[model samples]
Target: MGVHPKESTAQNIENIKRQIGEIAAIYDWDMEVNTTDPEFYKWTQWIFVQMFKKGLAYEKQMPINWCPSCKTGLANEEVVNGKCERCGADVTKKNLRQWMLKITENTDRLLGDLDKLDWPEKFKKMQAEWIGKNHGAEVDFKLEDRDEAITVYTTRPDTLHAATFMVLAPQHKLAAELATDETYHCPKKTMVYTPSLIWKFI
Candidate 1:
């Protein structure tokens, strides 16, 4: 995301070098800045190329919640008190192309190493909470009109006898249409309709 505009080059490059030095100092690492050095840019470019080679970097269009006035997408962790951080405007969902880090592909190995870290009890608990590990079977629901089935992950398969209702994710493509079906008894107003489906399974 860092780029040096040629017109603003000299001043911006010096500022970047200064910030890098400050960050290194805070981390107790010794480093020096040589802004006029071509080696620096070469290293940066090589890092970028390595990332692309590993298929870790790519661009795509993603639907996101954004505030037009602020011109930035709101991350799930960024929404606070129902206001935009940059412009104080109400955020709205929009379809736009955006870049995302592929952390899902690395989730398993990351979680497996959690116990190896020496950390405070509270922080370890938070880490476990963030991982939210659950072991369960994949169950499929047959759609009425479609030949295909929708699969949902449930950690409580042993409690199948008490199935009371079902809930589907709002982002699920079939949710809106499924909500109106007579056989399924989909509740009209809520996004977290899992309990509705779970009830039926009971």
Candidate 2:
């Protein structure tokens, strides 16, 4: 339905624009907006700067779909069946600096106001899901051999006694620092080690 701007010829671009104009005429649209306009993106950058100044945006390291061929990170939807949808390259988890919004700070007020809106029951439920608030307790566990403490969020804190092992993300410093070996000689009871990058500590 659309011709990619980067790869498309001038004729392709003109054809698509003509099709869109025909569609717009059917709806009697006042104007058509071109998303490739740099001026429009400047407004978005200004909005982000405002959010950053308000402490609503911050950078954090997070795992994302990485394409080796593209040498870039792809969104979750951009990865199809563990491969990059664009280049068909195998997608892997790579930690990259990502901007995060502190929308959770207003989740309470947002959820509270949803009930006051005149909407359908299912629509209100959808709004609640969009807010995505979770009631959980952040239990802090102290490391037995170190002065470090790990905090975990759980909706069921009562079953914490069964939490014999903790699964640390691949980006965790302990995953790289503490890993010495991978082979475990359980039968001979000689070697015991954590996984290479995915640490499953007991």
Candidate 3:
């Protein structure tokens, strides 16, 4: 009983509503709410429009966790082990135009306001941990043959001089650029580089 973005069209919504109605009637349940209903979604759309007007919502092209099977982008919390949490399908990074809400803009306010809530201590602690406030400086490392520099954020900038090796995620844009050997490049665009080669360059 799930409706994905692709199946949220007028015709498909009507079909889903009819199906749900039949099921509710058989069960004799008070199913007064239908999210697919235009009357309901219009308010949701209005709220989004208002947010956009206030500069709280914006559209940008960025790397996102994409579920190929579902044909939709997912949030960071919706992805598990590089897979879609809903469909259990392998998720890949895709640069797509997406609507982003400026939640970070209210981070400090939200964190301070949490003190007013009557929540359990453990729950409050978890929420605070999730917010993850940290003071750090971004230091750039120059690449050997490239004009580009890789920036690393660290809380302890003093220890950065002693750092010998650096690791980048397989999907990182620089991982492919830094890979010199043909074996490191794959048809699926997954980059793999040797530690020795990376150390030699850096």
Q: RMSDs, each prediction? A: 7.0, 6.2, 6.4
Superior candidate under TM-score, 1 versus 2: 2
Candidate No. with top lDDT? 3
Better of 1 and 2 by lDDT: 2
Model 2: CA > 4 A from native: 1-14, 21-25, 31-33, 115-124, 180-202
Ranked by lDDT, the better of candidates 2 and 3 is 3
**RMSD, candidate 2, Å:** 6.2
- Candidate 3 residue 143 C-alpha distance from true site, Å: 1.9
lDDT (C-alpha) at residue 97 in model 1: 62
The candidates, ranked best first by lDDT, are 3, 2, 1
Q: Give the alpha-carbon lDDT of every model.
A: 0.63, 0.71, 0.73
lDDT by residue for model 1 (21-122), tens? 778745333475555567778887787677777786677765576776788888866666556766777665555665554555566777778778898878
Tens-digit per-residue lDDT, 122-174, candidate 2: 99999899888988899887765778766778999999887666666544555
Model 1 TM-score is 0.53
Candidate 3 lowest-lDDT run of ten:
188-197
lDDT of 3 at 41: 86
On a 0 to 100 scale, what is the lDDT of residue 129 in model 1? 72
TM-score of each: 0.53, 0.72, 0.60
> In candidate 3, which residue ranges exceed 4 Å CA deviation?
1-40, 65-91, 182-201
